[model samples]
Target: MSDKEELYCIPSRYRKTENLHIVFWLVKDLCWVMLWKPLGLIMIIPTLGAALLITWQTRAIKSELLHNVAVVFWITANAYWMLSEFYSTDDSLRYYAVIPFSLGIITIGYYYLGLFSKKVR
Candidate 1:
């Protein structure tokens, strides 16, 4: 091939790059959600203690962590407004709290799942 033509040559269709991008992101999200919320919060202390056993474990200051932390706190605080419904029994207020809590959980899961794949490198 001439030098000019060589630059334009494309690779054969047989070669395909493996894409794990979506999968990695999903894993990060799952971890974040499962670790951040109250159910997950209960596990955090033990989780961190376990991490100390791994000398090579890398720590990343991911924005996702900050985001998840905010979400967890937000949901927890709103939970009072949630439970307050039981006193006077206003179902709507309690129902409203569910949305934020659910959203926070999903965000946490999505973001944290991405972290696992990142740390491997």
Candidate 2:
């Protein structure tokens, strides 16, 4: 197999960094969904950390550029949501926030489709 092909192949064992990445995101998302009210908008701290760590983990992958961009949008969306929750009552800001969130999701979908789809075999 070519180096590029090998690089794209899924690893047999999950790396510690990868596991941490998953755990971080899980905590982040759960906190955002469940604890946001009690946490009083401070939840973005851990979520931002999770996003940064996930972006760091993607650096080892072949599709790092796409992953990084997606993470950026994800972080931006989270920030917008947090800001709207804590500070902004502007309805327009809420509507604008969807753009980055949707873009982030779409980029992640594209990355998975392009690199990890079963059809790629």
Point out the worst 10-residue segment of candidate 1 by lDDT.
13-22
Residues 1-121, model 2: lDDT tens digits? 7766644543434355456655655655665666455453555566566566656656677477577778778777866775665566676776678999899889889988877776778
Residue 6 lDDT (model 1): 31
Report, for all candidates in order, the number of backbone clashes: 12, 0
**Candidate 1 residue-wise lDDT, 48-102, digit = tens:** 3332322112223355344645445444534344234324456666556666666
Top candidate on lDDT is 2
Q: lDDT per prediction?
A: 0.43, 0.66
| C-alpha lDDT of residue 79 in model 2 | 64
lDDT of 2 at 48: 66
Candidate 1 achieves a global lDDT of 0.43
Relative to the unseen true structure, what is the C-alpha lDDT of residue 64 in candidate 1, on a scale of 0 to 100? 32
